[model samples]
Target: MPRFTAQELDAHRAKVTQLLDKPSIKVGMSTCGVAAGAVLAFDTLVEEAKSKSANILISRTGCAGMCSMEPLVEVCIPGQPAAMYGNVDAELARRIINEHVLSSQPIVERLVPSIEALAVAYDKSDTPTPPGASGPRQYRIVLRNCGVIDPESIDEYIAREGYQALQKALSGMTSEQIIEELKVSGLRGRGGAGFPTWHKWQLTRDAQGDEHYIICNGDEGDPGAYMDRSVLEGDPHSIIEGMIIGGYVIGARQGVFYIRAEYPLAVQRIEKAIRQARAAGLLGKNILGTEFSFDLEIRLGAGAFVCGEETALIASVEGKRGTPRPRPPFPSVKGLWNMPTMINNVETLANIAPILVRGGKWFGSIGIGKSTGTKVFAVTGKIKNSGLVEIPMGTTLREVVNGICGGIASGRRVKAVQTGGPSGGLIPEQHLDTPVSYEHLQALGSIMGSGGMIVMDDTDSVVELSRFYLGFCVDESCGKCAPCRIGGTQILRTLNRIADLKGTERDIATVRRIAHAMQKASLCGLGQTAPNPILSALRYFEPEFMERIAAAKTARKEPGIARK
Candidate 1:
């Protein structure tokens, strides 16, 4: 294989752009799409294209983030505008081939242009608020490629300016320079904790080790959270390129993707991307004809939520039961078979390529203070436009929940917005204007965890919601420490009693006490923020609990019914 320099890479990218510029039909083949029968649609498209002898390329890409409109298909004819058709099945796929592909007509009812496209369309006109925007403001720094390109094909990724960052970093920038750039970008760890990425890289870079490693944490276990999964499924190459750039910056010789086995499609696409990179001299020795010899491997997690923790992930990669160990000797100091390793989440790594290509300052200016760039949110639950929405940081909760997500479906009053999955907290309607930054969310008793935002309406019970999150923590807790295992279970039981309207005020106090202990004493993040939902709900919706308690008391006072 021939190695390409920076200029050569750009030229190749231009060529790919020209190829994609021509008329074509695109299919969303992400897991959601497949679940909605996208495979049959894809097969039908291929068959129709073959039968008609059309020269269009029938390509498969990752999730477009609008999962509610699954089986999405994008048709871009030479003369007509590109259109996205959602809820596409085999019938629609065939119609798309006949009408959009063969003819110049677009399917008007199914057209859902991307937010970026919408922004461009309304650049001169008044900026119309999107469908839902009740969540916090966010920027899409890490999740730029998700739902934007064909993840399965490297050429498609290349056409969209992928791998250019790797080329730039490897060809022009040194390891120290790359680290400095990341520092300037103020990029923080996206894997729950908001640790500075540069510091982690620098620690591993300075650590005394001949053999170093970089791992992408793709074991996203938060229920209702699928940001990592979407990125892995939609733009596997972006993550791959980010890992390569990370390896180059940290002077690592090897990289590993620690993804959950439950995400079979994500794992499959990532594996395919790795193979393609290797074949293209992007992985393995002397990449791009440079002295940077970085190699990568895939390590599947056996569906253990604890493995999402860095130490536990490293242990799992070493072929052990996924469990967390104490951290003072952090992963940067000793990790992944006792080597100096730097672990970054899939979203964090995906941002690396863009940061390198568009300078660090360029990224830093996109969001609010300290928190730079865009964030991709998996906005689900009680919303009309449910899927992924990427917005700049500091975007208000109201904007995300109401404008982008179209507010609560069917005009129901939004009760709260749940951010950060089981490990996150619920933000009441009163705090809808809160800016979505790591610090802002932390102040509201929440964290900007892998960007999962579940909208809740009036019908949703706060006590029940808290119970659900607490229960998840109890189940996924590794049980390595008592505070997490015991305290989590205790909190769950108390919340359950409250949900069942059988608890006194004392039980609520007990829940708070246990949550505090777990927050303070738990070994890892899973246990630390396990009580976030409970505490946040208690803070904002104490009336809801009091109402339930009052109802229980009223029942007890009336007749022969006994209250537990």
Candidate 2:
């Protein structure tokens, strides 16, 4: 018998409904908020509530983005507006308990303007909403449970209709039916490549293998990017459920979560969730009392950027040095000890449960064109509101930068917006109006790689920017591939010369030649896209390179700027 049956789950949900019905105070206690003193705020809120004898529920949830405004605290009264506060400290937390919870008077100055006015703007879109929505700042699906449910509480996840999708999938759908549904949804892999997800699952299902595996790629190593980490830390169960459903569909007997060791809290929470899931009969053999049986375990990566690649990750998990191997025998056909393996990143798996719950057509109707769904972007750089922003895929880059993130905070013109981490190209401000679809971004000489978006202002140097991204790839290269190793280092040297205003025009040509060579000859995606930033700088901001070299003699020579 399963530890949690359908009736038991329904009972738990009903009990949770009563818990949520009361006035509640929730604190953003994810890594971002905790770094900003959310732990103290949570403690203070609890203490103040106890002392005041307030009839309110005090709990903790994950980051709601707006990391610049954390630690955030939200007070939801029975019928009044949900008063969300930002930049909250222990003192502000106490005042919130005393004034808002105890006395019922909101502190207006502390209210988060967007949440207060547009209350349902970021609500869990439990039902399918319109697709071409630039009117609202965000429409969340993957991030629906984040910042709303307590990360440690399984009951809270259950209350939000969590494992229902897994049950629905197992009971009602065949493997082929599920794949067809995914085909209808048009859900592409969020892990940079943008490969059609249904096609990958289909490949894995059809590939002849006695044993199959499902792996969640949580080795997020991108600088200033926390979209995957945030999802892993916030809504871990969703990833677990998605993996379980995937394991059922792929006829896999096991699932693995490959997370980085650097994410201690994420690791801790996912570990706890796995234990809870196994105990509750959501994992292990005969899941939820069904004939389908699957299990999960966690493996930690040693912070290798290359391990984020599937082959490299598979190699690392097999006790080999983390490195990429040549692909044609992709992981789908031959992976993880020569068995069929399906790998999807944190964001892609998080979308699975939601898609299954609401039919595929419902999901496909959300975003514009072929890009059908919302994307979670780790918004950082010189933007006003720096943090996580999950907007529909069709939303224009201008809507994200100017409308959602509130433009450049320094009052300087945006020079470019860099997407897809170090492997991505820079989109000049003039092209910001383009929608954030896979094709749209590729046309602008950039990929929607893993959703790491960085906003750069006019004061930022294109030469230095190119050098920094190239420098990162050069350092992170496993050195197993010659083109990436040599070409990346060579391109970095040329950028250094330009940044120091000591470059000949020939240096530009040298950088371009080496970059193209790397793109064509690299062994893996790491080397192939390593020169993207440099190539992008050359493509859109070539004059900056020429002007610096042209004025090298007349302009005062300055010391090479140290890498921060």
Best of the candidates, TM-score: 2
TM-score of each: 0.93, 0.95
Estimate the lDDT of model 1: 0.82
- The all-Cα superposition gives candidate 1 an RMSD in Å to the true structure of 3.3
After superposing all C-alphas onto the true structure, candidate 2 shows an RMSD in angstroms of 2.9
Tens digit of lDDT per residue, candidate 2, span 438-547?
Answer: 99999889999998999999999888888888889999999998998888888888788877877787998898888889999999999999888888888999999998
> Per-residue lDDT for 98-131 in model 1, tens only?
8777776767777776534533211122222333
Model 2, which residues run further than 4 Å from truth? 114-135, 553-564
Stretches of candidate 1 exceeding 4 Å from the true structure: 1-11, 114-116, 119-143
- Lowest lDDT block of 10, candidate 1: 120-129
Q: How accurate locally is residue 414 in candidate 1, as Cα lDDT from 0 to 100?
A: 91
